[model samples]
Target chain A: MDKIENNKAWFLVLPVFVIVAISAIIPLMTVVNYAFQDIFSPQDRYWVGTEWFESVLADDDLHGALIRQFVFSFVILLIEIPLGIALALAMPARGWRASLALVLMALPLLIPWNVVGTIWQVFARADIGLGGWLVNALGIPYNYTSDPVAAWLTIVVMDVWHWTPLVVLLCYAGLRAIPDAYYQAAAIDGATPWKVFRHIELPKMRGVLLIAVLLRFMDSFMIYTEPFVVTGGGPGNATTFLSIHLTKIAIGQMDLGPAAAISIIYFLIILTLSFVFYNVMTRMGTGERA
Target chain B: MSLQLQGIARTVGGSIHLHPVDALLEPGLHVLLGPTGAGKTSLMRLMAGLDAPSAGRILQDGQDVTGVPVRQRSVAFVYQQFINYPSLSVFENIASPLRLKGQERGAIERRVREVASLLHIDHLLDRLPAELSGGQQQRTAIARALAKDARLLLLDEPLVNLDYKLREELRTELRALFERRGAVVIYSTTEPIEALTMGGSVLVMHEGRVLQAGPTAQVYHHPASEAVAEVFSDPPMNLVNVEVTGGTARFPQGLELPLTGHLGMLEDGAYRFGIRALHLALRPKPGLPFLPARVELADISGSETFVHVHAEGLDWVVQEEGVHEHGLGEPVTVYLDPTRLYAFGPDGRVRAAPARGRGG
Candidate 1:
């Protein structure tokens, strides 16, 4: 009985564990190793204690970039969560109409992330883009290229357009997973539409919403491609988020030690925030920490 | 009309409309009895004011509630599913309606606890629906509807999801519960046993239309047609088409007998006739008349026995109370109680000449 119990089928997860450990753990260890060392060349390295971390902690550029990252994540969240729920509510519940609505909503999510950036890059241009022409025709000087506020607005709107579908799809699936009888019961209870949404739909969608928030927050925090492609950290660093600043220091200025410090700080920020997020999100479902 | 559904038929995606139901659903237990997909749910929703009936007006207490929204109608709908609120505890779910009506908190608490206790779910007061078993959840739903105090309760196969024994138990309890409340309950189910046992005047529906409606005994005794008779019993009512000629009804394959009473009223061509299993008996006596039959299958279930027999080439089930001593292939005599026999005309409607006895 003990032999039978211990006879685990190695085929079940042999390849998966190998891939994850090799790709994830080894790379993580390498990053950690690089975080606290002085590298003069690819072959030459020396231990520098917490010297890199100290410089990173003192860097004013890292601080500014950190603020920009949080602001973008918070703003994206504020715009997307409610908009996603609203879109989900508006979707048809049954028949071909529901399927068609779902397909349309999922279209944006299916597009490549970089393609989404490139499409919006052309789409948000002042001269040829529809939005630009509309604003210019309306007699407003709407040049996102030259204006920091316009650039930030463009980046936020582009991100919303590209990623709102993820939130909408998650919330829609959550809402659809609810049985029709629940709605019937609510109606029998004499709940108005608003009350039904608040008490039933809101509570039911909490788990999915929590997931959406965490996923979107992490993605927006590590946002690199879309804004990098669209704004190019332009309009005088107004749209230069954490990733852009890190890349500029590491690759542009070629400062290996301080840049390594900055990267370590960025990694720590992400790890800490993500841990907090997982705790908060996990608590939402059961109203208790596991 | 109390609850008017005039020319009510629904056609979806060019398929045939189930049928047009034009009848008044009166107050008290209106047990909608039919086979599955007889548009029972569609009819219940239309009656509950949850849905709009095509080409019809739903008049509730003589009001044109066809135009009124479900919320305005004050109708309570209890689905077959256990649909209690997952986020709310049992107490909260039961008290939600009272709070919505702006009832005082003390009164709401009193009523909620009373109903919860009445339903035997008091111990589960603080538990969410997600934590409860199916039966408990179903009881919670019933408790919630009871809290609404709706004049009409549209229970759409509400007890169907429970297991067999639990279903019967709940059915009796629900019947008593509804009776105590004096509520107009239009409880829909395709199961005839539910209609029969639940103390409701039966409304037999087939394909969305009301086939017949009366006290269970009356309807069972004089089922408007073969279809109506078929709708009343478990293992169902057995039919044997016969020829009635010159005050004589004869089973072409089995035996010929004198139809002394209503045989002269018989029409031409085939007469689709029915005799419920219980209505026909098989016992020997000195003077009593009997029909010769060959026992084809004597299915002796513990509660009841269904003796499938061939008499004069006509086949039917003879419902027996005690166990049948006869073997499956044995020859036996069936005593046909002509008074309990039902006859349908060539067109399958109940012969206006009348039937003698009830199935109850």
Candidate 2:
């Protein structure tokens, strides 16, 4: 077969490049510009170089927020991934029940993030909320507004309730994609149910689990609106994640240059972590299949 | 161990997949020969306890195990598609069954190596299933099944997915392997040559029913019904409708063939005369009846040749050894021994007769 050398294909890709530049690249460049310059007015901008970056990096508050952010993401992932896989395994394999379960699992994901925060905020109040009232009725001292532990627990539980469904849905799809022949062969081999899941289902779900991990990691690392609406980073900054801190720097105190620098650093952190995750996961998945 | 299926029937969604079937399978290689949608896989699955039968019971060594799940039964099945634990190496895949039974690691390794060597895949034990070819993957699956040491082994068209040359090689290897395993192995296939080469008891099935079951040679030489004969022959048994009158059967072309023995016992009426392609000689010999046919198509496959002839408004396939060229539309005379022919009564049942000498 003769190859068709067509330079005209370059013209087809030009529109996509232009759209990306207008939608993403241009805005990112503006942030990059803001990170390096101090602007007192529209025309009174002065170059600051790495001064704001150094300050943001040295700030103890920023360090604390970054640690808190890491802890939250790590804790949630440890809980959510296993819980989701177990839920997916327990779900119905077929029929109307499967359809209904899928819809119910997807309900939390469909709700707006801020709406989830608002709902939890009202639902966790000690005087009127069911959860808070029940806890108090059970003779436990639980007040999220005053106790740091209670606030952290409430935020983690709220995040789990709102996001664990995503992991469950992805794992469920992975489970369903496995062919029935594998299970049949395993059964005939006298494999126990745990052995079946460990050898067959877990290996087959590796690719989807990787995706779920990456998605949940990046999303949880950048979480803002829910915590911001619920606790507003209160209880002596116990739940003040990096995103909330960045927002407070950029809008609450109007420190644009340091906020821009922190934003760039946060983006780099996520990018580096995601790249590491993707490389490790793809290697593992391909290595097993290979 | 002896495995018996007692009046087993399988129905899915209110439609019958396999009607009630009862058969006693002894310890040896038994071939289940059938065409597609013949319920061969379903029957195998039921026997392996992978699926419960809608009716009847399964007995193993005179013990009822119909209610037992597949994992509790000492049975192993190899599917048409080569199924392996994709994440595991060939060694691990074979060792998995023993591991599931909580066997020690040393014993598991020994059994895995033994089965791998038997299947000639010991060198590929470290490789994953995806890295292996179709034939290698199936061999690995077979090795895994063998390592399990199940008393009853079920293989549903295990070689159907392999290439022609690989299929032939594996068929020979599998026949020997089954003999050494000392298990009651039930192998299903749609190919007649495979059933013949395996050389054991044969169960001929069609449309969810068992038409015939007996020794492989007995079924081949004497199919119980026209349906069984059709499924038992490669180009399908050449069945010609004949009218019998005065102890003689006459073809449509007015050729009167002498009816002897059991064929002569039938009252004068319409009957079906069946003959295998190999029994029809292209050349006429002494004491053999000849039929006039016109060559319609000649299909030469490797060393064997199949000549399709239109004889008296009926198409007949004649199998010939080696290559023999015959021009299309050429008039030819094919020889067939009357004693070797099978006669089917009006009800489609084979008319049983005393065994005759095997002829070329």
Best by DockQ: 2
The most accurate candidate by TM-score is: 2
* Model 1 DockQ, alpha carbons vs. true complex: 0.29
lDDT of each: 0.80, 0.90
lDDT value for model 1: 0.80
Clash pairs (backbone) in predicted model 2: none
TM-scores of chain A in all candidate models: 0.90, 0.94
- Across A1-290, the per-residue lDDT of candidate 1 in tens digits comes to 35465436787788999999999888777677777888777799999989888877787878888888999999999999999999999999989999999899989888988898888888878889988778778998887889988889889998898889999999999999888877876766678899788778887888888889888988999999988888888888888999999899889988777777777777788889889987877655333112
| lDDT (tens digit, per residue) of candidate 1 on B1-360 | 256667677766676445777776666778888888777888877777666766677777777777677777677888888876667788998998888889999999999999898889999999878778889989998898888888778888988898887898888888888877656788888777778888668888876567888887678667887788788777677677778777677766556666655555665567877767876777764444467788888888877888889866578788888886777678887776666667888777877323544336
**DockQ score of each predicted structure, in the order shown:** 0.29, 0.43
Worst lDDT run of 10 residues, candidate 1 chain A, spans A281-290
- Best lDDT goes to which candidate? 2
| Per-residue C-alpha lDDT of model 2 across residues B38-101, encoded as one tens digit per residue | 9999999899888899999999999999999888888888989999998888999999889889
